[model samples]
Target: MRAAVFDRFGPPDVLHVVHIPDPQPGPGEVRVRVLAAGVQPFDVGVRQGNMPWAKVEFPQTIGQEYAGVVDALGEGVRDLAVGDPVLGSTMLNGNAELLCVAAANVVRKPHNLDFPTAAALVAASQTASGALLELGVGEGDVLLVHAAAGSVGTVATQLARLAGATVIGSASFDNHSRVRRQGALPVPYGEELIAAVRDTGLQPTAALDGAGAEAIAQSVALGISPDRIGTIVDDKAAAEHGVRVVRAGRDPERLARVIALAAEGKVLMPVQAFPLSEVVEAHRAVESRHSHGKVVLIIEP
Candidate 1:
């Protein structure tokens, strides 16, 4: 099996694919022949050695989410079978040709969802859905999403709209059209952000920040109560402003629900793909912070 691994944390050049021993399913786990893997900011953090609590070995594997076909099943795995198409969250080993993960954690992929798109939804879906749930966003509310063109914010905007909230999304002028297409009114970010949102004629009842510290401050300027402001990106700013840091952790159920919506064409995630061998370039794209959509590694391509 071949997998992307890094011996030392530094730049994108630190990542490279190399042959490693194939892993077999252990009890309650299944081995998946990975078709695609989502590249996340978390993966970038892991690669740069920024996550102090992430357990890292010298030659460490660094992906968190993947979609693939099941090749083998561990003992007691009754709900899924060999050859099943599944997508799910994994820990530090998803960017590989084959990965073993707990069968309980994997979600069955709908036939309508391609591997890359399915993989793309895994983390962002979970994060966005969880954040919305934590924020209690719903009918009669106006939700403000910072960095709305991003993976998490894209999902967040759509899901909030589905839940009956009016959405105002902040992005650069270039991405405003994309943001509006995601069912939100688009507002340009930076110093003029508050005025931009104000011009939309909607008072933000709650805010979700996917951008950094500046987003938090701008949301506060909109007169949204600190309790109603949730941030997944800037915890330090969240703490300073007395805003909630919504740790929208991984949840397979949340991911599955969003996946179902995607399969039905109710939710969409655009993908920018790189073949597995070009893992370094993929990492660099995510690091550049200008990727147009979810960046994914097409493992089998």
Candidate 2:
């Protein structure tokens, strides 16, 4: 198996592909031949040594979400068979050509959803859906999403609208059209965000921040109650502003719900793809914080 591994915590240049022993499934797990994998900010953070809490070893494989096909099942695994398409969250091994995960954790991929797109939805879907649930964003709520052109922000914007909330998303001027297509009224980030939101004629009742410090403070300045404001990006800013730090941790059921919505065509995620050989560039893109959508590595195809 070929996997992307970093020998040291540093820049994306430290990451490289290496051939390693194929990972086999343990009891209650299945080995997947990865087709596509989503590259997230989490991967960049861990690679750059920003997340010291995550255990890292030399030559560590680094990726968190994958979409692939099941080729082998562990003992006692039933309900899923060889060749079934699946997509789900994984821990630190999704950048590889093969990975093993608990069979119970895998969500069956819809026939209509392509591998890269399925991989793209894994993390963002779970995060966005969980955040909205925590904030109670639904009918009559005008929700403001910071970094609205981002992977998580894009999903959050669409899901909020489906729940009957009007969404205003903050993005770069070049991405405003993309944000609007996701059903958000797009505004620029930084100093002008407040004025732009005001021009929309919608006072935000709830906010989700995926950008950093300025975003949290701006959400506060917009007059949304502190409790109704959430930040997934900056906990320090979240604490300083007395807003909710939306952990939005992993929940298989939550991910499955979004996957179902995606399958039914009610949810969609745009994907920016790179081949597995370009793993370094993929990391650079995520670190750049300007990729229009989910950054994914096409591992198999």
Candidate 3:
């Protein structure tokens, strides 16, 4: 099996493709033939050794989520069988042709989605779902979503709107149309953000920062309750500012909802697919933060 492997944290150039032994399913686990693996910003942090607090176990396999078919089931795994389609996330080791994970971590893939889109949906969508819940957004409440044009922000806007909150989103001026397509009122960042929200006379009751921009704190200054403001990105600063924190990487329920939405077609993931051999480029694209959507690495057909 071929996989993207790195020994030390650095740039994308440090990633290399090599023939590694195929991973076998252990007890309560299953081996999946990878169809597509999701690339995330955290993956970049891991590659660069930036997250000293997280304390990554080195010689690490770096990927957080994937969509694929079960190729083998290990002992004690009764619910999932060979050939069952599934999607989920983990701490690492997903960018490969085969993945071995515990059965409890896997969920049935939604009937409506393909592997590529399903691959992109789980991580971002889940985080967004958790964000909505953390803010306690409700009907008649105004929920401000920063980075509305990005993947998680787009899905978060839709979910917030579905929950009956008036959704307002921020994006660069060029991506305003994409933001609007998600059913939120789009406000461009800069002078336009505060002015645009104020002009509508819809005072925000809660806010979620999907963008890591420091300006999110400024948006909170615009009369929204500081306690109700949460961020998926600015975890460290959010705590310091008395804002709520929604941990994007961990929550299982959040990941599950996103997977269900993808399977049901209620949520869509824009994907740029790269073969497993191009994992380096995929990692670079994700690191750049300029890609239109989630970047994924595909393997098995």
Q: Pick the candidate with the highest lDDT.
A: 1
lDDT of 3 by residue, 1-301 (tens): 8777788989998888777799999999999998899888878898898877756664667788888999999999999889999988866788888889889888788677888888888787778887787778889998888888787887888888878998889888777888787888888777667888888778889898877556566666787887788877776778777787787455556677766765666766678888988888998888877787778888854
lDDT (Cα, 0-100) at 135 in candidate 3: 76
Clashes of each: 0, 0, 1
Off by over 4 Å in 2: none
Give one digit per residue, the lDDT tens place, for model 2 in 1-301.
9999999989999999999999889999999999999999999999999998999998899999999999999998998999999999999999999999999999999898899999999999999999999999999999999998888998899999999999999989999899889999999998998999999888999999999899888888889999999888898998888999998888888998898898888888888899999999998898888876789999863
Q: How many clashing pairs in candidate 3?
A: 1
RMSD of each: 0.8, 0.9, 1.8
Clashing pairs in 3: 110-263
Residue lDDT tens for model 1, 44-94: 999999999999998998899899999999998999999999999999999
Count of clashes in candidate 2 = 0
What lDDT score is found at residue 30 in candidate 2?
98
TM-score of 2: 0.98
TM-score of each: 0.99, 0.98, 0.93
Native-vs-model 1 lDDT?
0.94
Which candidate, 2 or 3, has the higher TM-score? 2
